[model samples]
Structure formats: structure tokens, C-alpha cells
Target chain A: MRHLTDDEIQGYLDNHPDSDREKIRAHLDICGQCRSNLENYQIIAGQLNTDHIPALSPGFTDAVLSAIKPDTQDVPVEEPSRLIAWMSAAAVFILGIASTIYFTGSSVAKNIIALFSPANITEPSFVSRYKEYISGIDLDLTLVFAVALVLAVIALIDRMIKRRHKPVSFMI
Target chain B: MDDKTSIVRKIVAGDKRAFRLLVDEYQRLVNHIAFRMVSNPGDREDICQDIFMRVYQNLAGFRHDSRLSTWIARIAYNCCIDYLNKNNIPFIDEEFDETISNMPGGSITPEQQLYKSDISNLLQKEIGLLPVKFRAIITLYHLDEMSYAEIGDIMSMPEGTVKNYLFRARRLLRDRLMLKYGEEELRQ
Candidate 1:
């Protein structure tokens, strides 16, 4: 029989059935050189099996622990409630309008008062002045733009907060 | 829960003590893989620390499909590969080329070199001189006692490839041992 190849010997050593281990075994019984080769392979395998695993240096665990930031570092930032933010913006807008009316005098104030009073809404002078103010300012579009700006600011703040909570490695 | 699951859960729950336990438990495995892949002794500790730090960061994503050690080893293997790539080191696996110089023998005096002539130290030194892929296969198979399948997962190779690499690595190591120390010296 031909000598067992190194691969076959390795397979036999590893207990792989692909090697026809029994055939190699039988051959080894009759062949001195093949037996010696097998012995050599076994010795090498033995050394590898017994290879030393180097120990970690003292305080290695502590060193690793210290290197890792605390889990709290990754905690998601607490976002301000969106509803509360919107309500605060609305309150500020209303207060600004009320202060403007208070400072601008009774003519504009009466017009503003007339706009809120359903009974006086159809009075011709008050209605003409209110219509003039509405036509001049385009209040509907202004409200839409103001609402959009507030939403954009809220989204920007949300994104910044989320970005800050991203893992530190990502920043690096 | 099994010990691994318990440890993983605790770690995920933000337990620093459990994270410490994890580092204590797997430091040797990580260090072994790192030492085998990275020939520079100075880089091994940093690599190990980086591996565990990554594990901590990604702990929440680890599914229990494989052993926890296997997962950690996979991370270690990938980190070493990245390090090699970043440093532009070529990974040679097929034949042992003696022309390529081994890593510098940092801080080893002549006396230390003489004392390191023991078979084990010589064997380890030779293993370190091997290409990173061969060193990793030998480390996973022999030192870590990992199965070929697990090694395949860790190294991202097929099981057949894992077996082939294991056989080739051992044969190369044996040949190196025979050439340097002779058959008689190996018989010991």
C-alpha cells in the first residue's frame, strides 16, 4: 500500500472519517516508516493541544472596564413632550397678540375686540377695518408659516438630541 | 437561564459588575486570538480591550444562536482582520515563506533569547511567525478547543475550508519544528 499522505494523517489525527482511518491504522501496523510519520504527527498535535495560553496581565479586567464608558452614556436623551412645546408656542403667540392690542390703543383694540365678539362682527366700520387688517397681513398664510417654523425647530432639536445619544465610537 | 444568558442579560441591563465578569472570563480567549493574529506584543492588549469594548457596545444585538465564546471570538477575529487591513499587512496562508522577516523581538535580551529556547517557547515563537490566518486556525482549534463548525463561523469560512486550513497549519508548524529543532528534539 502507498504511504499515507500528510493530509490523510491529519484527518486520521483529527478523527475525520474522510481519511479511511482504519486503512491507515492497518497500514501503520505493517509499515515502520508510516508508523514513525504518524508518531511525529501525533507529537506535533500533542504539542499544539498543550500549547500554553498566555495569562492576562494583572488588572487587565479593570483596565478594560475602565476603558469602556458606563452604559448610562448610551441612554437615550429625554425629549421634551411635543404637545407641551406646541402649547407653549401657542400661549406665547396669544400673549404677544394680547400685548400688541393693549399697547396699540382702543381703535385697533376695538377692532380686535370686535373680531372676537360675535355680536359686533357684522358692524360695518369694525368689519371694514378687520377685513382691511386681514387683507393687509394675509394672516392665514402667516399662521401656516409660523406653525411650519415651530415644527422645523422642534425637529431640529429632536435630531440634535438623538445625535448626542449616539454611541461614542461613532463620534470618533 | 444558563450562565452565558444570565451574564449577557446582566450586561445588557447595564451592570458594570457583570461587564467586569465578562472581561475576566473572556480576556484569555480574546488575548489568545489577538496574540496569534497580531505578532506585535504591544498591540495585543489594545486589541483585546477594543474587542471587549465592542462586545459591550453591541451586546444587545447578540442572539443566542451560537455559544457566547464563539460570538466573542468572531468579534476578536474581525477586529484583528480590520487591524491588519488598516496597517496594510498581507495575510499569507498557503506556504511558509522564510524570506519575510518575523516581527521584531522587542526588548528581548540575548540572555532572554537563550532562555527562551525551551520547546514550548520555540513552538509558540514559530506559531507567532506564521501567517495570521494559520495562526488563527491553530489558536481556535488547539487553544480554544473550538470545533471546525464554530471556527468556520468565527473565521467566516466554510467548514471544509476550516478543516483544510487546520490540516495545513498543523503540517506547516510540524515542518517548521522538524527543520529548526529536528525530529529528535520534537520527540521530546
Candidate 2:
């Protein structure tokens, strides 16, 4: 007689199929090796079933609870709308760029016009004004760059502070 | 509403007390999965925390289709898999013969044999040594008392595959036991 396959033996152990189970039972009764194998499988199954689950460490619930930040009230806090924030930021950036261009372009245009004016090109007074205009443009550019650098530094510091203050959910 | 639904609703409604209650209720279930999947005792707590945080963050999106426990379990299982993949831990599926040959061998003293707990402890250690998949299936099936279908849902595998894994895992454990303690000791 052919021996039962592992699947068949497992099915028999699980009581999966009625007919197949009966066939295995008959075979086990007649065959010592299969019977022993079946017993071995049964013991292992029993042990697997009986294995104990270790309990969570003491204060486990408290640890989890402590990690979570509790809402102050039942009502959810209304966060400032992100769309409004983005639109405001975009408006500020556009305004800054537009104002810089308008001021610099107007100054440059005035200097260029003054230089090309037939009478004013050689005038000492016009030359002084043109030099002043050039210096003013340089100063304006320097101020804009300084303001941008300061804003970037402030934003970076603000981000670092927020991250440092953010409550960590896990202990580690 | 069912208890689960009521609890979930309270949690989603910014009820910290309700969330605490939910955590208390499911801590063991999460711990069981995390502990079995992660061998390192130090990492288990962090993994459990991460799983619950994910659950809490996504609580608002939870539809009532599946049981809350199953949903949490799925999150836990995914977290475990992520931990394994992230750490580059090799979850090799060793063949039965290979596992048996590598099984730790030493005769149990007569005194040790007298205590059944030692045998059970050895069995558990061997279970822990099984591949990640096998450890997961064994824990979910036997310790958590989850059905094969639930395990399949959590692990994202077909039910048949779950059953096959379960069987193979158990057989590997059995073979390990036979090798470690001899067939005579196991038969008793």
C-alpha cells in the first residue's frame, strides 16, 4: 500500500475531508509508520496550540498613553487654512519682486535717459546725479539681498525650534 | 452601535480618554504580533508604539468593513514587515532538511526532561528561530487565536497560502523538536 502524503496526513490530522480522513484512519490502523508519523504530527500540533504568549511589560498601556498627546478638549482644534497661508506667501513674494523691479527699473531708466540727453551728458551736475543713481541701485540690491538672507535664516531657525519642541510619540 | 464602532467614534471625535481605552484593549494583540515578528526585545516596544500611532493617525479613515482588531493587526503586521525590510534582515526560507541539520543538538538532562516547561520553552525558542513568515503565522494562528482568513487578510496572501505556511511552519517546528529532543521525548 502506498503511504499517505504529507498533505493527506495533514488533512487527516485537521479532519479536513470526511472520505480522505476515513481512508487515512484505515491506513493508520494497518500501517505502523504512518501511525507513528500521524502521532508525531498530532503532538506538534498540540504543542503549537499550547504555546503561551508572553505578557507585555509592566506599564505598557501607560507607556503608550504617555506617548500620545491628548487633545485638550473634545472639539478638534481648527487649523489655519493652508490655502490661505500659501496664497498670502505667494502674494508677499510677488509684491517683493515686483517692487524691486519697479524701483530698480525706474532708476536705471532715469540714468540711461539722462546719459543720452544731448545737453546733460557733459554736465557735472548730471554726472553726479548719475553716479548717485548707480550707487543707490547698488545699495538697494545689497539691502534686498540682506533682507532675503535674514528671512531665510529666520525661517531656518523657526523650523529648528518647532522641530525641537514637537513632542515625540515614542520614548526612543 | 457596536462596542467597536462606539469606541472608534469616540476616538475619532478627539476623545483622548477613549483612545486610551482603545490602546489598553488592544495592547496585548499588538504586542503579541510585534514581539513575535521582531526578535530584538528593545525594538518590540518601539514597533508597537509605531503601529498604534499609525492606527491613531488613520483612525478617521477607518471604514467599518472589517473588525477593528483585524485592522490594527494588519497595521501591526505591515509595521513588522517594514521593520524587517528597513533593517535589511534576511528572512531566508530554509528548507526543512537544512533547518533540521542546523537545529541545535544536545541531550536534555533527566532533570530537565522531568519539567515539561523546559520542552515547551525549547519549542518556543525554535519557533522564534523560524523565518519571519513562519514566526508570524505561528503567532497569529496559535497565540492570537486568529483564523487563517484573518491572517491572510493581514498578511495580504491567499487563504490557501496561509494554510500552507501554517502547515509548513508547524512541520518545521516538529522536525526541530524531533531533532532536539529526539522522537521519544516528543512522543511523550
Candidate 3:
């Protein structure tokens, strides 16, 4: 008969249910070489079976507990005053732009009016012409442009804030 | 109704004390995986903490498909692997011959190096020298006493693969010990 393989020997040592323990035992009883191999493997298994894991330092649990943020799942409520301030500022800017468009009759205002007018919907060529006209016109619309940029920045910041405070679901 | 379900519910309901208890329960298992897979001592603590934190974050997604310990171990294992990848550490699955032949007994105490007869210490050094995955398998199998199927779930491998790696790991460890100290000393 062929001698037992290492797997069989280990399976025997491990008392693995699938291993033919009686067969392996019979072999080991007669086979000195396989028996020696079993003995050596047993020693290795003995060393591995020992609890060699080092203990983590004291207060590991407390440190982790302390690090956990409280109410992590709760969404932070946005301040109503901040929201009001943003809305008021936006309203003031829109009012300023409306006043400028009404009083100045600026060519920029004409293009802006044309860009939104219902009459321009049917005239496809008016879209490209409007773009060309707006690009060519040198209006002193720095205030308007600056206000629009600020509003955009404010909207982006609001989105970021909302995202940061979004409530996490407790269950999937 | 069961203890695990109740504990998980308490934790999901934002119970800090329950979370603390959960951390206490699994810290040893987490530490074993972290220490076995990650070599850097300095990063081990942080990695362990991160593992627990991740467990907390993802606990809501736990679907009662596996044991809580097994789920936590899977988190710990993945966290260590991610740390290894992020740090550009070589977690290769290469054969152990070159590595074992090349690896010196890992950073040992001067006294340990001097005596060199402590079999447990030698075994630990050899374990450290194994490929990361093998070290993890050894820890999960022998230290944690986890079932092969549970280890398979934790490591995202088949049970057969886990068994093969475990057998190969033991064989390599045995062969190395035998070669170094001979059968007589090991038999003792």
C-alpha cells in the first residue's frame, strides 16, 4: 500500500471527519515513517493551537467609543436665518437686475429679453443670432455678471451643506 | 428576538453603549486579522479602529445572512487588505519558497534572537513570513477557530480553496520547522 499523503496525515491529526481515521491509524501502526511524520505534524499543530495572539493595549474599546461621533445618522438641520439671508440676497440681486434691464435698455438687456421671449421659440435662427449678438456686445454688465457668479457660488455651497448633513438610512 | 438581532437593532438605533459592547466582543478577532495581515505595528491600531468604525457604518446593511462575528471578521479582513493596497504593500500570492528562504526571522527581541530555541516564537516568525493571505488563513483557522466555510465567506474564497491553503500552510510550516530544528526537537 502507498504511504499516507501529508493531507491524510494532517486530516488524521486534525480529526477531520472526512479522513479515514481507521485506515490512517492502521497505516500509522504498521508504518514507522508515516507515524514519525504524524508525530512531527502533531507538534506543528500543537504550536499553532496555542493562543499566540497578543492582547491589544488597554482602553482600546474606550478609545473607539470616544472616537464615534454621536447621532451620526441624524441629519443636521440648516439654520433658518442663513437660508433667509441667502434668499434675501438673491431677491435683492434679481431686483437689481430687473431695474437695470428696465432703466438702461442696454443691448445686453435686449439680448437677455430676446433669449427668454416666447416669440424666439419659433425662430430657430434667432438662437444662434442671439448668441452672436451677446458675444459681440460690450455692455458694462460687470455687476450683473458678478451677482450671477455669487448666486451660483451660494447655490453650490448650499448643495454641499445639504450633502454633508444628509441623513443616513438606518436600514437598507 | 435573538441576541444578535436585538444587539444589531440597538446599534442601528444609535445606541452608543451597545456599539461599545459590540466592539468589546469582536476586538480580539479584529486584532488577530489586523496583526496577521498588516505588518506595520504603528498602523495596526488605526486599522483596527477603522474596522470597527466601518462595522458601525455598515451595520445597517447587515441582512442576517451570516453570523455577526463572521460579518465583523469579513470587515476586518477587507479593511486590512485595503490598507495594504493603499500603502503599496506587496500582498502577492506568490509561492512561499523564495520568501521563506529569503525571510529572516522577523524583527525579534535581542534575547529571542540570541536564544532562538523558543518554538512558539519561531513559529510566529515563520507565520509572519508567510504570504499575507496564508497568514490570514492560519489566524482565522487556528487562532479564531473559525469554520472553513466561515473563513471562505470572510475571505471571499471557496471552502475548497481555504482548505487547500490551510493544508499548504501547515505543510510549509511543518517542513520549515522540521528542516530547521529536525524531527526530534519538534516531537518534544
Candidate 4:
């Protein structure tokens, strides 16, 4: 006959308080480790069987319930985190820069026209060249408006695309 | 109304006084379970109160299919387990020392009931150090004198599993106690 495994002996050891039970009896005869383990389990179980439950503190239950229960009238309001505040600030800055470029573009075009007026005709001098160079700022400002418009359009399109697709957090 | 159903009705009717009625009855039971699971009075108190307050808030959602005690016991057990995992607090709550100190050997109680035999003391310490579930299984099955069926109800586990836990908990208890026995226990 095949001998009982350690698990069966362990199982028997756990369920049977009497160490002298037949299955445990047979197993212990042959296996020293099983015998030792069984004996140890008994000693432990015996000790545990006598344990006392802890006493309740004075008004302990009431104290605990009171401590954790939120006030009925005034639930605490939650504040948004720092990251959200930073994102809002960045959005405001970007909008300000774009608005500045848009408003300045027309004024820049008017100044470029004024700078080219014919009354001041010292055409061959370095100062005229320097003035022309200086006059380019208006065109450059218009160019900034153009670039800003393109960037705003691209950003809008990007936002629209992202919104349409709407990266949803799906959990399976 | 059936007991749990009546309690539910009272809590739902917004009878704040009825809330205390529920607490008075279930507090010891929940505290006992939490105390066993966490092994600390303070942490056990925290867990016990958490379970009840959760019950209070979620009372409207309570279905009367299962016993209220069982439902709340599950809550108590789960909260203790969560606290252990979240804080890595080693299942034995800080208040466990207070409970341990109050145990038969551990407590200074003059009551004969508090007087722990040496072997019992060794076993208590080991159970105190075991995992929360192991501690709970022993407390419910042996300490509370609950049957496997009752334990199954409290834990929402099958009776077979409760038996398994009880046996394992007992064996573990035995092994730990034997360690302190030296050769004297063996020779005996």
C-alpha cells in the first residue's frame, strides 16, 4: 500500500486534536518530521484555544464612531491641485501673446507705410539704409501676426482632432 | 420586521437615535473582530468605527438578502485588510500591544478569566503575530466559539474554507507554542 503523504498527515494533524488518531498515528511512526510537526501544531493549538479577547475601552465604540463620522452640515470642500493651477496660468500666457500679436499687426502695417514717405530723401546716406533697416520692424511685426495666426489655427485644429477622438480611459 | 431589516428601517427613517441602537448591539461584535484581526486596540477601534460609519453612510443601499451582521463583518474584515496592505502596517495594529497587554498573560486583570496559562500565553503571542486572516480565523472559530458555518457567514467564505483556516490556524498556534516548550514539553 502507498503510504499517506505529508499533507494528509498535516491535515489530520490539524483536524484531530488527539495526536494518537490512527492516520496521524501511522504517519508519525514512519516520518520523524511529520511527527515533530504534528506535535508542534498541537502545542500551538492548545495555547491558542485559551486566548482572551481584548476588553473595550470606556465609551470606546462611541468615541470611535464620533471620531470618524463627518459633521452632517459641513462636508469639507476639495481644492484643485497645483498642476491644474499651473496649466491654467500657461493657457492665459499663451492667449495673451497671441492677442498682442493680433492687435499690433495693423499698427505695424501703418508705421511701415509712414516710414516710406518721400519728404525725408537723403537716399544715399547710411542713415537712410539704417532707417530702412529700422522700418523692417513693422513688416517683422506683421510676419509675427501671420505666424501667430497659423500657429493658432494649427493649435485649434489639433485640439479639435484630439477632442473628436477623445482619448477615453476604458477599463476592461 | 426581522432584526436586521428593522435596524435598516430605523437607520433609513433618519431616526438618529436608532443609529446608536445599532451601534450598541454591533459595536462589541465589530470591535471584537477588528481587535482580533489587527491586534491593536487603537487600530482595532479605528477599523471598527470605520466599518460602522461606512454602514451608516451606505445604509440606504443595503439589501436585506443577507444578514446585516454578516455584511458588516465583511466590511470590518476588509477594512482591516486594506489598512494592513496600504500602510504595510504588519496586520498587528499599534493598539495590539494594548490588547496583548490585556490578554490573560498579557493583562494585569485580576479576573481568573484573564489569568492565562503559560502555554496559552505562548500561543496568544504567536497568533498576535500571524497574518490578519489567520488571527481572525482563530478568533472567530476558537475564541468567539463560532462554528465553521457561522464563520463562513461572517467571512462570506464557504464552510470548507473556514474549516481549512481553523485547522491551519490551530496547527500554526500549536507549532508556535511548542517552540517555547523546549525539551520539557517534548519529554512530557
Tens-place lDDT digits, model 4, residues B11-122: 6665556777888877766776887767555676667767777777677888876767667777777777787788777754324332323433333245423423445554
By DockQ, who's the top model here? 1
Candidate 2: pairs in clash: none
Task: Report the CA-based lDDT of candidate 2 relative to the real structure.
Answer: 0.75
lDDT by residue (B6-33, candidate 1, tens digit) is 9999888777888888898888889889
**TM-scores of chain B, in order:** 0.86, 0.88, 0.91, 0.72
Interface DockQ of candidate 2: 0.27
- What are the DockQ scores of the candidates, in order? 0.35, 0.27, 0.28, 0.15
Query: What CAPRI grade goes to candidate 1?
Result: acceptable
Cα deviation at B18, candidate 4, in Å, is: 2.9
Q: TM-scores for all candidates?
A: 0.72, 0.66, 0.70, 0.50
Displacement of the residue A78 alpha carbon in candidate 2, Å: 6.2
Residue-level error in angstroms, candidate 1, position B95: 6.0
Q: TM-score: which candidate is best?
A: 1
* True lDDT of residue B81, candidate 2: 89
Q: Deviation in angstroms for B71 in model 2?
A: 1.4
Evaluate model 3: give its lDDT: 0.82
Q: Which stretches of candidate 3 lie over 4 Å from their true place?
A: A71-172, B98-113
lDDT tens digits, residues A2-109, model 2? 998877887777666433766788899999988888889888777777747777778877777666664333434454446544544654674576465676876765
Q: Which pairs of residues collide in model 1?
A: none
In angstroms, give how far residue B136 of model 2 lies from its true place: 0.3
